[model samples]
Target: MKISAVRGVKDILPEEVWKWQFIESASRRIMENFGFSEIRIPVFEYTELFARSIGQGTDIVEKEMYTFQDSKGESLSLRPEGTAGVVRACIDHHRLQPDSVSKLYYTGPMFRHERPQKGRYRQFYQIGAEVFGTDNPWVDAEILSMLHLLFEQLGISGTVLQINSLGCTECRPVYRKALQKFLRNEQASLCTDCRRRTAGNPLRVLDCKRPDCKEATQSAPSVLASLCRDCMAHFEMVKGTLDLMGVPYEVNERLVRGLDYYTRTTFEILTDQLGSQNAVAAGGRYDGLVEQLGGRPTPAIGFALGMERLAALLPEETNHSRAKPLYLAPLGDAAMERMPLLLHQLRARGIPVDTDYLGKSLKSQMRQADRIGAAYVGILGEDELNDGVILLRNMETKAQTKVPLEGFVDQIAETLAGEGA
Candidate 1:
């Protein structure tokens, strides 16, 4: 019986992994440059954690989550997103003290049981960043600027940044009520999901992708129009700061993100290259989530980008070229005995080196080296060993240099360093 991978999951083969690594490393570099440290949260958490943080009415909590019960009769679930688990960790560790700020980023796989399509997978990876303990709109703009810098550095073009305000606790209800009332009148035109959301989470109905729902809600009450004095001013400052930082964005009044925890400002980076799944990255302020999850009242905002989607958009030229490893080929048993020590000595000096232990012929070994993209091949045959020398061949230029065995390790290191320089 041929056992295959389960459906909805994908194996990222070696050929495709460079794209993923390039995106991840670029994200890490941009994040660290902005003073954000990396945090690794668990892949699964107590079911109630997600239920409490992400509202029970949200699609993730209601349908997409992968939930199961343990032997102890406790329900746990694989995380569908990173924010809830990150917030849980911060509160659990008492990292969110009054007047303290923490900037954290996480990258890992999130599990959901939805039907996978072009960039969506059951086990998908995300690179996300979060900032806590600051309500200042400057932080919002700074993070957006950081994202702009990341995409610019990654050479990913054709992305549009859309921003919106979801209003705070004090003013959201007013908008929600008005939007709900408008949706109730157009209930016949909405999809089944939008119809159910109309009463419980009416704001979500406006975000529905159904053509009918979009057309029906074309005149729906805008959340931006309903923002209170404070929320409006905060949003204004966010936009002003973004302008001052030279980050281009459009104010999208209907851009309420999928998560229920989101409060004031919301934003998404959209690319038309991906069909219906246009949002490559999305996030917003979730100021109330900390308190909602048993922590002191805190203000925070963050965003996450889908790894698969971003990888797909990356061009071939975006991958940073890497120095190839040096391949070691030994011709005879006597030469093989000396090669291991030489390899160990060379590696201790920080050279990327590899060898084939199967004792293949010189021609076969050279082919293997070429197949692995080796830049240089060090041949230690019995003749060279007898002469106290090793024949080093530059695979790219086909240049051969005879390195003396007495101080061959240092000589090879110097040679590589010179070439690199």
Candidate 2:
């Protein structure tokens, strides 16, 4: 009987793992360059944490979260997103004190119980970053600028940057009331889930993707039109800063994120290549979440990029070609026995090298070397051994040379360096 992986889960084989590595390395480098320290959070947390933070009516909380009871009957859930866990960590660690700012980044898997599609998965990875302790619109601008730099470094262009203001508590209730009225009137046109959400979280109805829902909400009251003076000013400054920094963006009047905590600035980087679920990255400001989760009042903002989508969008040439490795073909048992030390010496010096340990034929080993993309092949047989030398062949040029085996490790190392291997 054969056992297979669970449905909706995937194994990232070595050939495809390089793309993930490239994305992670590039993300880490860019985040560090912007002074964001890395932070790791637990894969699962108390279910209440998400319910309290992501809004109980949201799809992520109501339908997508993988919730279960622990041995003690306490509820626990695999995280559906990164920001809530990050905020919980900050609060638990007392890192959200007055006048102190915390900038952090994380990369890992998140779980959801939903139909798996091209880019959306029940278990998927995300690269996210968060900034806490300030509501300055300049920070929002800086965050967007950092994201812009990341996409540019990844060589991904033609992505549209859409921005919107979700207003603030002071004035959002008015917009919420107006939006609820509008949605209630269009109930026949809304989806079942959206109809249930109309009274509790009307803003999310505007973010719906269904044709009927989108059409019904197209003329829905604009949250931007109802922004309080302070919220309007903050949104303006964010745009002004972006203009000063040359970050192009579009103002979407109905671009509310699918989270309850978002307020003021919300944005997403979209590309048409990924179908309807086209957002590669999205986030916004959540100035009230820190306090809502039991911490003293604090301001925070962050964004998460879908790892699967980002890897899919990565250019074909980026990180696709690796430095060719050195292949050691030891033809006899005696030659095989001597390879470990030589292999270690070369590898320890940062040279990529490998050798056959299966005691295969010279021709078979050479074929293996070619299959593995080796740039140079070192062949040692009876003739070469008796001559006290090793035959080194440049796989690319088919050039062969004999080198004394007495100090072969150092000699081969020098020759490889000289040949720019």
Candidate 3:
């Protein structure tokens, strides 16, 4: 058998890399502007970290994790999501110390074992932002605004932000039991996963992606309807703040995000651009998680965006940047001798440059430059070399100019700068 990439993982080819670069670059700009410090955590952690934080019954812990026992007999797992690892790092470093709050952002590959599709992959990248040590609804509103601003900056519109309050510890069990009772009647129609989750993780039944499970839970009890007074008040404050900021949203009763950690105020920003798996970003409040993971009693909220899903939704031809290199075609012994120095100088001065290093014929060199889409070509022959000048030709306009070698570097820099390069 021919060797290839593993079944679900993929190589991001050179041509497709610019789209990813655009997303990562934009994420850093927007995230730093909002004051979220970048956080880098280990790819693999103790398996218990996920089981304890993400919940053992959750599909992520139960099925998707790429887990293994090391030779030391300790079990570890490649993180399936960013939040659990981020929280673990925070607790370990005492980030919750002395009235301190940590706002963190991370972008990298997360591992999972899944059947890959259009926007889902076994190893995928997610851009996540988390705010720790605050329970204020205004913080939630600000996070939502920043997330909205990101999509807007990327030129993706018509994304609907659907918000819901999943109630708190005080009232969640009540809704859970009611949902279990309701789903029990439709048990036969439920998918295998939903039926299995019905007893212990009934709330997750609402998050199931299967068509049968979705239909069965259509009339199931909504946590929004069962929100306690405090939960209701908190939810109201979040909505009011968003309204005051002029952020448009709808109260989606069915928008229970696919996580066990989320509490009061869950949301998923969706678009029809990607079909069934349309959620580009989703997250909510988890007031009890910090303490659950051994940190001090802290409240937190944040979101993770599916970069693959977002990349798929981006416009095929808009604002994609390319490096406009000046390709050099040196045709004589002296011109070739001078080529390397010119290459170094141009690079040092921040001008993008390349040259035919394989000693191809003049015709072949010109063809190579055009094939590589060079914006300008620098042609040096015996006559130009003797005169200490170069024939600089614009590939687009086919205009050539005699540029002196002693003054060439500065002249080309000024010319390219003038052309808005």
TM-score of 3: 0.93
Q: Model 1: residues >4 Å from true position, as ranges?
A: none
What are the models' TM-scores?
0.95, 0.95, 0.93
Weakest ten-residue segment in model 3 by summed lDDT: 93-102
The lDDT of model 3 is: 0.88
Residue-level error in angstroms, candidate 2, position 279:
1.2
lDDT of 3 by residue, 284-342 (tens): 99988888988888899989998888888788875886777899999978789999899
Model 3 stretches astray by more than 4 angstroms:
185-193, 207-219
TM-score of 2: 0.95
Q: Order of all candidates by lDDT, from best down to worst?
A: 1, 2, 3
Task: Point out where model 2 deviates above 4 Å.
Answer: 188-193, 210-215, 419-421
Candidates in order have lDDT scores of 0.92, 0.91, 0.88
Q: Give model 2's clash tally.
A: 0
RMSD of each: 1.7, 1.7, 2.1
Per residue, candidate 1 scores C-alpha lDDT tens digits across 1-421 of 9999998999999888898888888899999999999999999999999998888877889999999999998999999999999999999999999998999999999998998898889999999999999999999999999999999988999999999999999999988988888999999999999999888878878888889999999999889989999999999999999999899999988887777899999999999998888999999999999999999999999999999999988987765667788999998898888877888998999888999899999999999999888988999998898898989999989999898889888987888898873
